[model samples]
Target: MLTYNLSNIGSDSLYEHLYKCIKKDIVLRKIKPGERLPSKRTFAKNLGISVITVENAYSLLMSEGFIYSLPKKGFYVADLNDVQPTKQVHQETVVLTSGHTHYLADFSSNQTESEIFPFTTWIKTMKEVLKDNQKELMINSPCGGILELRKNIATFLKEFRDMDVKPEQIIIGAGTEYLYSLIIQLLGNDIKYGLENPGYPKTAQIYKSMNVHFEYVNMDSYGIDPQELERKDIDVIHISPSHQFPTGIVMPISRRYELLGWANKVKNHYIIEDDYDSELRLGGKPLPTLQSIDVSDKVIYMNTFTKTLSSTIRMSYMVLPESLANEYYKRLSFYSCTVSNFEQYTLSKFIENGHFERHINRLRNYYQKKQEIILNAFQSSVLKNKVEIYNESAGVHFLMKIKSKKEEKEIINNAYSKGIKLNPLSKYYSNSIENNNIYVMNYSSLNSNKIEEIVEKLKQCI
Candidate 1:
């Protein structure tokens, strides 16, 4: 008999819960193949659920090939020989999943200070848009994006990033992941992609899930080794040259030019420039974007407003080359923009009214102070002798090389035992880089007062 205690399945829809329970039994062969299922009326009466609920659950299962029904008879379980049960992964990783323990001072987030957001200004802008632009909000943005938001982004880019970007060249999406998928689709899967080792793992994970061919390109102090790029058959290279993630190595002009020269070597070569946090460069003069320097139309520039604005805002934009822009329209013109019109218009107003610049400035100052407090505490801590500040050039994170007599696993274990949840530099790498003592610390969301507590714990552990 189908057993479902609906009262205990809190937070799930009744029909959904029924569907899932039945599906699980079918998959596990508890309800064997070809076994008859109770009719909707009978099942509803037995379970004390509405007949429509039972019908909905059966319909879902039948639609999904989990069950089949005869015209005059009840439903029968479909053959689920192809349905394999998922296995648990026992491999050890420094990933911050639900499996990882909690912490007092979590330093593994790139989330901006939510307290610093201009909520009043944003609410006011949103209201203004809703009042006058209700029709615009109801409709979808164009294939690329709304003209107003794209134009403002272009202007912002030219002013802040020194990129000679046109509005039509910009493609707005929900976030970097969506934009990345679009990029893969636009560029075609035939090309070999090169991702930076010891870089953002999410990019690699996305590529893998899409079943695309990609390799890890090793990096140096300058950036991805130009020689390594030249030797590989990689047709596309995704990088954050302005300020490389995890490493924080800002590529110099020589390296930038060298990269451009390398991209020009092969016909149809492209460089995906992930300038994620360029505006948050807390130190040194802001360098021109890689796309700004590329005359060959090789660089694809991407950025988002999450770090400067709010994490909840999922708007991320990309600038395609002129030729590729036309190509994208020809192939993907039917695809609507991922960002909603309300958000697009609101963000446009935010940028157009100079509030965006102010927000970035305020966040830069705020994070600079936060970074200083954390860094100062680390320097003045008892564990300072064992830890060396590696890179503090850009973004809210800096690398620290821990010099300890203990093994890497033991050191990490000790830190975890002390309730210091964190990750080793090895966590980000995909085989090209060797991880020894380096670790990444993102203090953007860490409270100022918790620094001493974390440092004291680390001192005791390290």
Candidate 2:
């Protein structure tokens, strides 16, 4: 009789312990293909467990394709060659836990609160647009964008961001990622690029996939160091000046000028300024974009509706410098397709009719109140000393530096056990850095009640 020890497993049921042991043996290829498994009666007798427990383990293994049973003979190790590994199919599905209608707290992503979305007004406008512009809505828009929408965007930027742009200069695409990809293609592969260190990983991943040569520029509270640019013979710099991701630090005016001056010194170089989440200023007026200051036509401004409106919209526009706009159009005309005509028409009307501004103003006020609620919750909680909040005056998300002596993995694992999800700061850094204690928390998605719940749970977890 082959005897298996069950004493090693603590607190786990007999079936679970057996399942884990068998699963590991199969994965490590200890059990060769066609190897016969012990009969449930024999296995249970040898292990001193009930037959039902062994049967359950075998049933699970068979369901997962780790083992197979012949009609009369018995169960055996599955043929490794015949059994293909399961693959996760990617789909456009947002996974939220149901039944639990409200979460005590969640800090997953900065999404508009439920009450902030103008669903009624949006539906009314959408219906009106569909009724009035039926013909135009069915047809494909121009590659650049609908002329009216482009004009609205141009005007909005000029008034709000102080950008000097024409309708022809703007190109609308799916989102910031798509626009970045298009920009990469327009610039071609020969140029060297500079990306911020401890910056958005997606930017680096995208550029790296295109086989572009890029260097990392270390960032400080003031923003990306201009002195770092002197070390690199780079042709383009990708920057997020308004609100830096993960860190949430705003790039100061002095560094903005210095960066522009550096770009001027580097002949044939350009700056890709991603002005993401610049409109949600909590206290001061919105800063003028780098594109607004670019007299040499060296800055390519990119903005998206993902932060302001719903991320599902996937609407983004880029303001190309006059020097590259014509060439970009010629290149994009051949390959790029415009967004939906109906959406373009609706958005154009939204801006023209002043609904966009009204929506923004409402969201700003809603988020400001939400920010205060979060701040208050943290201040009153036991986690006050354990977490140091950064850049709380602006943006939808803020950084919290974990002061506990425990490892980051330990903290994350503990949080996970309590059904809380957290984004670790270490994931943002590509190069070595000193501050590994930071974590990005988004309060925009939760209500005051939810925020309190999350903070309370966090206190207990810590």
Compared with the true structure, all predictions reach lDDT values of 0.83, 0.79
Span of 10 residues, lowest total lDDT, candidate 1: 92-101
Quote model 1's TM-score. 0.78
Q: Write the per-residue lDDT of candidate 1 for residues 311-334, one digit (tens) a residue.
A: 778999999999999999999888
Best by lDDT: 1
lDDT of 2 at 458: 73
**Against the true structure, what is every candidate's RMSD?**
12.1, 7.9
TM-score of every model versus the real structure: 0.78, 0.80
Q: Judged by TM-score, which candidate is best?
A: 2
Tens digit of lDDT per residue, candidate 2, span 1-462?
445666556645556678879888888888788889999888877776656567767877887778999998999998767856568676542333332322344566655655677788778879989899998877777788888899999999988888879998999988777788888888877888888877888888888888988888878778887777777777898998898877788888888999899889866688999887888878798677888988888999998887888766879999998868899877668754557887888888888888888888887888888888888888888888888888877778888888887766556544543446677777788865554667888777766766776777677556
Clashes of each: 0, 0
lDDT of 1: 0.83
